[model samples]
Target: MKKLLAAALTGAAMLATPAMAQADEGKIQFKLLGTYVMPDGEITSVNTDIVGLPAGTQTTASDNFVPTLAIEYFVSPEFSIETICCMTQHDVDAVSGLTGAELVSDGKLIPATFTAKYHLNAGDVKPYVGAGATYFWWVDAEPGADTIPLGVTRTTLSDEFGFVVQAGVDIALGDGGMGVALDAKRYFVGTTARWYAGDTLAIETEHDLDPWVLSAGVSYRF
Candidate 1:
């Protein structure tokens, strides 16, 4: 029994060594970070529903304004975890062609995401790239106004699971444990558009998020 207890104690003590090594490796101190994103282009899609509807009814998708904010934790010299939260407003143009009219639908606060990243450090200028999964919860949405015959607005965009890829580099500061970093990335975001007037209208669309995000900011090493 004593031998077993000693062995367990030794094992537990051994576990602490890595944490101590990491602590000895030290970490960066931080508070807040900001980022700005630009879409490679206006994301748009044209889709139509056939079978139940009369025919010739189609919807167009468009988006505007891209921005994101991230707070980072440097777990090691080459790894870190991060959360990216963003917002966007979209304009949907629907035309029946048969009815000879159009309805314009607008604005929504989309589902946001939390992600973990692996940072790669190189030279005095550290460069890193990695991937993470994100989940979005939708908020603040409204359907389009009447601009056509029986024209209903698109209210919400549904997104399930998504894949993200990232890349960035950092420049070290002479003192104060502070440095400047430049980062960029594209997230393959996915979602469904939901429409309703008294009945349910749903169609699958591609966000083509392939956003071209760029940011320059300061980081602190604890």
Candidate 2:
């Protein structure tokens, strides 16, 4: 009887090993995604309009699609910390006052972000909600065609800090550590646009840069 009990205990241990290993494998997840960035570049207020913008001056930022990489570390079964990396380019155009005119050209930005997420598991699917902070890093920009014609030789956007709210889901493909991911985030941010003619500041405007970021792709956990 003693020998039989020992054999049963050993078999139970063997049965549990694979489950333990699988749990450990999901501590880190890496995702490759295609992201859509849409921003509202409306002029909230014009601080300095030396170039004489009209009364109904307004702007809109062009939407962009870019490749994004996300990395997540599971703090527990239901909690994770995640960060994403990507660079998106955009152009700001006048939609009202000087209709169809470009005001800022080829502005490149990197949204450096971090979030703490709470995940809920249901069968093979996990849904999550997160809130985070972001810093809009303006890497490069130039005066638009219309602005350049207006003695605008340089243009710069101020880097600012903002907050973001996110929601997403992960669908497991199989018992393997691969899955599909879909995510959406809303950002609340603002920036100051300054146009320069030689060494003189020609125009300075404040803009609301609230953007909707959407992403869909595959994820792998190891």
**Displacement of the residue 140 alpha carbon in candidate 1, Å:** 2.8
Alpha carbon lDDT of residue 24, candidate 1?
Answer: 48
- For candidate 1, write residues 1-222 as lDDT tens digits: 999999999999999886665464346434234555443312245353421443445554454545445667776766777765567655555445424222334445453554566655454576878678766455544665543235554455665666677788767676456777677666666555555544545433344444455666676666
Scored against the true structure, residue 32 in model 2 reaches a CA lDDT of 100
The candidate scoring highest on lDDT is: 2
What residue pairs are clashing in model 1? 27-222, 28-221, 28-222, 29-222, 111-137, 120-128, 144-153, 158-192
Q: After superposition, how far is residue 11 of candidate 2 from its true place, in Å?
A: 14
Best by TM-score: 2
